[model samples]
Target: MKKITNAFRLTLSLILIAVVFSGCLIREVEQPATVKTGGEFQVKLTITDKTADANAHYGAVCVLAPDDWEFVSGSYDSQVGTGIFLFDSSAKPVYGNIDSVLAPPAGMKWIKLLSDAAFTNPADVIHEATINLKVGQKTGDYNIGYFTTKNSADLLGSLNMSDEDNDNAWSDTSMNHKVTVELAVGVEDEKVVPTKFSLDQNYPNPFNPETTIRYSLPVSGYTTLKVYDILGKEIAVLVNGSKQAGQHSVQFSANNLQLTSGIYFYELRVGDSSASDKSEFSEFKETKKMILTK
Candidate 1:
């Protein structure tokens, strides 16, 4: 009888060890290596079970986002849950009995993704969760935070973790993900502006009912384009308005003007205009001559 009891006790101990070992799991995050400012990108999370338990499952995942980024939507797993919770810079979670979406703490900004059902299928290599995000206008390397949970509760003490330490929390493991951003194509740097002002001669000069006038402004100010006869008489005001510091063009049609074919001069002027007064750039004037024929 003593021998039988010893054998039974040993068997029970081994069974408990197997159960504990089967619950070991780790999270891996995959995301785009780089993205452009204001562009949308995808982040993928793969959860791997070291224990290979068919019954192991997770209900939620909490992620920390970089500054200037916002949560878009996330991929939904019907096998897991029906809906997900969206959080920004300010979020607080309830530690217990998280059935639905829980708001983050006041002044705490975080992003929590939830599933109604639960992620399972340990037989598969991994379970996946994908989230969409929008990149902000800043350019630099950004880090993302990852954590696992059973329900809406604090699964990995993520709520208590600070944003500064969140990215480094998983650095020891291979679960860290960094996203790189650059300025979008064709988007000029905010610090750059025009440096010199100049005007180009009209094209198709010397003979035509219509001509094109081009000019450049070194600074943002009021500008005007006037057409005058060779005798110094103002024939028409082609352009009179505020213009940004850049190259601009205006097309002039002589079809409506009641003038015979002759040589004409076009002038460009720039100045600072006040709200109470319509100023002119007359002090800074440039002229180019063109000819028109019937």
Candidate 2:
């Protein structure tokens, strides 16, 4: 029978080359959920080998933040294994290298690593991984992600991935990649309450004897800040007490008051009803103008 039909076609071509060189196939080229608190975000994970035969390594991609947001320090960097690798001496085919690692702690600020070159070949492969957050004046929502390893297996327990908000889902199959990030907490309003009562103008303005007079009281009353010299009398008070509406700054050390420069005036008072009615309170007075160069 022609030697058993050529030994059954060489045993089905070595069993289809051992089922295409076994397993290991990760995927996830830039998985961004959404990022916009301080701006800057990126994510990408990939590992393949349907039959490329050997070559896929990844270790280091851990990002987790939520506590007002703060990670702006040194900033790390790594685009898939540092570079330099091209072989073909005699059919050493095992190409498919990709690596991207980053670690940002102690203030956080390591942005850049979505893939610079790992096993490259994700239908063409692409890379991107960035992180930078600093928007917290008390608002709301936030979450982050990242974690993976290969060759020794730990693909973050199987790999399916899911994150609508931010909680650490999981994904890793040698390189089946996956990512998630969400940050939504608005309404900072620039802070600085004190909508009406005005009095601001005393910063370095011809200041040599000291300057810094700002005032604004709209509600929580019982306040007072004084400083006068251009024929107004009162030479020092700074602040009296009670103050809690937002925006407050006091520092006018004129060195015990000697008097020798030019114009200077700063006054602010609030103590009518102490803001009690349903109006949340509103009783303020203002006055500003400073210039004391000596």
TM-score for each of the candidates: 0.38, 0.19
- Give the alpha carbon lDDT tens digit for every residue of 180-219 in model 2: 2334445453353645665544555556766666555656
lDDT by residue (tens digit), candidate 1, 1-294: 000011111000000000001122334444566677775555555544332334534344454454466655444333333333323222444333222323222222345544433444443244455555655676766544444444423333332222232322211112234455777775453224546686655654444688777677877778889999989999999888888887788988888788788778888888875444556354367776676778
> Model 1 TM-score?
0.38
Model 2 scores a TM of 0.19
Number of the top-ranking candidate, with lDDT as the measure: 1
Residue 92 Cα positional deviation in candidate 2, in Å, after optimal superposition: 63
Candidate 2 RMSD computed on C-alpha atoms after optimal superposition onto the true structure: 24.4
Residue 191 lDDT (model 1) = 29
Worst 10 residues of 2 by lDDT: 10-19
CA lDDT of each candidate?
A: 0.49, 0.39
Give me the candidate number with maximum TM-score. Answer: 1
User: What is the number of residue pairs that collide in model 2?
Assistant: 20
